[model samples]
Target: MSRSTLRRALRAGALCLTATTAAAVIPAAADAKVGVSTKRLNIQTGSRVTVKGHVDAPGVAKLQVQRRGRWVTLDRDRTNRSGRFVLRKRIRGAMSSRARLRLSTGETRLLGRMNVYRSALASWYGPGLFGNKLGCGGTLQAGSVGVANKSLPCGTKVTFRHNGRVLRVPVIDRGPYVGGREYDLTAATAHKLGFSGHGPIQVTK
Candidate 1:
């Protein structure tokens, strides 16, 4: 080839080699060692949850929670000299799934089972008490979504699941007040779950 053609070919070859090297180096950087953990697997709403984790290197880490089909920022912190981080946050909203902890380096970790969900035998009530004052404070209505528990503190959230349906409600009333019944779901809650009568159910507190 001519001198100019040879020079051009050499430049193109050099650029291709450089690109190949970068592609290999990029993946190595992405294979970072990072991990995270939570203080508890299950907790109540408005309670503080502690998150602790470590990265392979010291950097800023971000905490996020999955809500309404999206990931939202919960908190952020800088790792210590040992690449360890501690973040404490009060969970105020309803999150049905685990929270995510991600590092600036692209390594991510999951904090699974972050809230209370349980199984129980549950029945629903509403018509008789509709418009009547609940034991907690609110007036029961057809649209009210909640559960009645004999011992669980009022305002505690309860999630119900049956027949492939799910409903997250609050402990707004007292109880079913009958033997063998663990929870009494509000009319709206039962309707949402396509439940009609009593049966084996899942109730998360």
Candidate 2:
């Protein structure tokens, strides 16, 4: 063969080999991506839930949880080089939930659900605290049914049934510290519920 023709053929063969190698490497890289998994399928409301799972990647990534169309971002970390990711978050409402992880180059999605129940006890706060800054970044009103929780977020709204009456209260302040009470009722709330004294009630979110 002429020298020019031989050189041209060699160049074509090299190009073909490079293309073949790339085709094989692409799928293998994708297959090496990480993923997440969970042991529990259902979670309960008014209670803390832990999401346990692992990923399947070479390094760490960011994890997240989605519930009722709301997204909660998880912390960033590395996977066990085996590409496993395990994480957890609290169940704040009575709705279905899902999770996803953003790794170095890809993402993994998982599905889950939460089951909420009525509160066994309920309460509220206001009055002498009117115009006071609430944990929810709003002014407190004596006429409004708002409670305070030490741990629950500031703007959480909980509904409960008492004396055949149903009421929903926004969480505002902090605590009762009186007894092992699950909730502390404001004076106005107590009167509205027709309960002169703190009593048992049912609550839900």
What are the TM-scores, per candidate, against the unseen true structure?
0.50, 0.39
Error of 2 at 165 (Å): 1.1
Could you say which candidate leads in TM-score? 1
Worst 10 residues of 2 by lDDT: 33-42
TM value for model 2: 0.39
Could you give candidate 2's per-residue lDDT for residues 121-194 as a string of tens digits? 54445557777776667666666566666678877776655676655677767786666677776666666776
Candidate 1 structure quality by residue, lDDT tens digits, 34-96: 766545545455677678777878788887777668877778899998888887777665445
For model 1 the local lDDT of residue 139 reads 96
Candidate 1 has an lDDT of 0.77
In model 1, the Cα lDDT at residue 146 comes to 81
Q: List candidate 1 segments past 4 Å from native.
A: 1-97, 101-117
Question: In model 1, which range of ten residues has the least summed lDDT?
Answer: 36-45
